[model samples]
Target chain A: MSEADQGAVVDLLGVLAYAELTAFDRLAEDARMAPTLTGRAALARMAAAEITHHVRLTERLVELGADPSAAMAPFTSALDTFHESTRPSTWLEGLVKAYVGDGLAADFYREIAEFLPDPDRALVLEVLDDTGHADFAVREVRAAIAADRRLAGRLALWGRRLVGEAITRSQAVIAEHDRLADLIVTGTGDLAGIGRLIERITDAHTERMKALGLRP
Target chain B: MSEADQGAVVDLLGVLAYAELTAFDRLAEDARMAPTLTGRAALARMAAAEITHHVRLTERLVELGADPSAAMAPFTSALDTFHESTRPSTWLEGLVKAYVGDGLAADFYREIAEFLPDPDRALVLEVLDDTGHADFAVREVRAAIAADRRLAGRLALWGRRLVGEAITRSQAVIAEHDRLADLIVTGTGDLAGIGRLIERITDAHTERMKALGLRP
Candidate 1:
């Protein structure tokens, strides 16, 4: 990779690290709003995992001798805007946000991880939360929907809006970092493959919605 | 143990677990205010450890067949009040709060863990963040003081105020939960021992403050 590419990757990693750190914080606060102790604890555990990701990313940045704060600074405003705009107002809303928002972020990261250099790619892949956690969120959403059928529509809509906002903000991130976009395009081979990947993500999301008894 | 005693212990566990969970959240949020990425990530990692504590406590509560939420509910108001009243308005203030506040809480938990049953006691002991994390906070605070020696007096006073509020709120929690107080007193053998324990905690706090370049 060229010097500029390495700098860009470091920048991306910093943003991701800080984003994970802040996400953990926000989710922890949101856990207080949970209606059940079980729910609260579950969300809190999920939030805690972000710190682990943050630590790994920060360690890598340190090894690269980059100032994580400066590298992360450019993307902070965009990420902050995304979070502020999509702040969940209720306990259920928070859960949906965690489920849908994190799931999407993970999917995007999985794609982006392919674009990175050897050890970094592996590191990013390893840091993504396991399917067990994601499945837990899915199960909770499904159970809630089963208990109150009416919630399905509202939550499904909320999940859609969350994805919409995530995509929009992600585009903003990509636009601001052309090298990252170039890396993704080149790494994935073509736009068609990328589109197919998005379709798969959307399909999985729709399946999740259906599992929660909601129409896509 | 009698049924009521078991219930009380579960209650205590719930409160402690929830406290750890929320503390993890608050600390992670506070970490963002850190001046450096290394400092921020360090605190975030510390926050993650709290979840492990939460999980252990939650499992204990479940084993007792007690609802963790019900167990945690009674103390929520008091805990929230304490944090709200002590909310730090600046980055340094946040560090001081984490350093002083978490240090005191850890010391108190160490004393209280003695009253717990075998596995729970061991769990609590294992979950406490190591002195290294606390030492980092101490170094940060002391460095800030060394940079501006005049700031020492105000921060020392702030540290005292934090300890005072913590003590006041803790007393209120104990007063409200007679069973919890009895557990501590009985497990420790007498009121005098409990007093001595408090003294030890206070001395430790003073030492910590001194380490941070603040007067006891």
Candidate 2:
């Protein structure tokens, strides 16, 4: 890869690394809202899994001769802003955010992975794999919604809000990182290609919301 | 062991399990205070390690035919109170708490492990073994103290406060759990035995503080 390609790869991995770290922090904080000890433990396990992914991504950054913290620093504010704006006020809301919001982010990264070469592609795909807590969220949300049909409307709105915030932050990240934008454009073949990618992610987000008994 | 011994064991494991879970929560919260990404990740790893220990203890509870949540429920408030009272306000304070606070808890658990039967004894010791993040805390705290000699005074008092709160909470727990108190008394063979145990734990805490360049 050329120097420009290396820069793009670092930027991509850096955002993903910082995202995992922020998720770990947020999920752990959200665990406090859980009504049951079992629920809390489930969320804590999810948070722990994110930290494991973070360690891997940072190590990979070091191997690429980029300082992990410096690489991660640039994306911190954008990620923190995204989390801060969508902070969940309840346990169920937190679960939906973990499931719907993170699912959207994972889908976007997986789409971007297609634009990368060899090992980086493989590593990105691997870390983006589900952290095994999705089923728990689905079960809890579906049960809660089933018991009170009115909750569906409120949570559907929350789901939409999460996707909106996620998309806004992601666009800001790509806009600021010229190399990353070039890499995405080059991978997709044109500006329209990026548009197609967002459509696909949005479609997936709707499906995820439906899975949780929330209307898209 | 009789039925009373079994009950004591359950209570003991319950408190320890809850303690680990609370540590995981507090340590993850404290990670947010870290001044650097590396420091943040290090504290996160420590928090994740606590969850691992928690899983083990809870599983052990399950093996004994106890509901893990039920076993952990009884002591949550006491553990939560101990943490709430000593919440760290800064990164250095957080590091000292992780080292000095957690170190003191580990020492107490190790002492109690001796009174446990075979596998419980081994399991407690294994989980209490350093989570591989102690050296990170030691290094950070020592480096900070060296940079500003005055920091030593504040952190030293913090260490003392941690021990004082810990002792008070521990006594409350003992007073409430008659079976567990009886187990300790029986294991020690007398009241003086319990006194000796606390003295040994205190001395270890002092040595730990000295290692971090703080007064006991």
Candidate 3:
């Protein structure tokens, strides 16, 4: 691969590895907030799936001769801040975050994964694949909203906040990792490519919010 | 399987399922206490392994037509209390708990695993396998103890408390779950078998404590 492509790949994997790590942390903690043991265990299984992805991404990093920890270091703060600022106060909020916020993030990564070379592209796609175990989240959140219509308004606001925080963190990650930015801008052929990338991410986020019965 | 064997199997699977679920909960929470991102990930990965075991046991329970949550419910309080009472206060305490506390519990499960027939016995043995990702814990704790001899005094006490809490809960479980107790007594060919089982578990605990640079 070209040097810039290699750099982009490393940066991408690094950001993703850290995302999985933080996802595990936030979900595991959130599992504790679940109202039922069944709910808690389901959330925990989702948390486990994130670490499973982290293990794979880190393996690829190591294969590329990067220190997994060092590669993941740069993106840790941005991801942590995203989660910290958006900490879910209730089990419902936690489920909404899992479905809406993480769904958007995964869509963005899937977009980037398309711009990569053979094995790396495939690896990125595989790792980013649905952890969409968010089925439980959807069922629970939908039921909560049905039982109390007021929950819909609050959760809709939470969805907006999650998207807002995610965008801010994405920008921070882009500013801090120019190589990653170049991958999106140049890999897709120009500034318009970057525009289209952002647009696609936003569209997907809207669809997810709709799926969760929340207004975007 | 015999009716008694069936009851014994359900009780055993129930206890193990809850054990794995709580292990995941406690380890994930304790991962926060890790001093380094690397250490945190290690603990989180260990926590993830527990959930994997839980998923399998719960699957087996469902195959046998048992409700996973219902099967796990009986031991929830005992397991939760063990964790609640032994919540680690610092990074080192977390590591010690992961090692000594989990190690002893795994030993006990492995002993129980021996008497059951095929698939269930195989499943138990497999689930109880070396979450021995404790190499990290061993190295870290040994180094910390070497650096501060007085720390050993406190940690030794912590280890003892963990064992004490575990024993009290084990007795509570046995008292409450006669089917599980009968499995030990009859499955092992009577009371002497139980004696040998206890002896084996005690011996293993002492060895693990010594390996951690502590007294049994």
Candidate 2 per-residue lDDT, tens place, B9-93, comes to 8888888888988999999999998889999999999999999888999999999999989998889988888888999998998
Compute the lDDT of residue A152 as modeled in candidate 3: 93
Looking at model 3, the pairs that clash are none
**What is the full ranking by TM-score, best candidate first?**
2, 3, 1
Off by over 4 Å in 2: none
Q: What local lDDT score does residue A67 receive in model 3, on the 0 to 100 scale? A: 90
Chain B alone vs. reference chain B, TM-score for every model: 0.93, 0.98, 0.97
DockQ of each: 0.59, 0.77, 0.80
Per-candidate local distance difference test: 0.80, 0.92, 0.89
Report the lDDT tens digits of candidate 3 across residue range B143-212. 9999999989899899889989999999998988888888777767977888888888888888888888
Query: What's each prediction's TM-score?
Result: 0.89, 0.97, 0.96
Docking outcome class, model 1: medium
Poorest stretch of ten by lDDT in candidate 1 chain A = A129-138
For candidate 3, lDDT tens digit of each residue in A1-216? 998898889999998998998999999999999888899999999999999999999899999998988998888888888888999999999999999888888998998889899799999899888865888999999899999999999999999999899888898888888888888777779878788888888888888888888888
Q: Order the candidates by lDDT, highest first.
A: 2, 3, 1
DockQ ranking of the models: 3, 2, 1
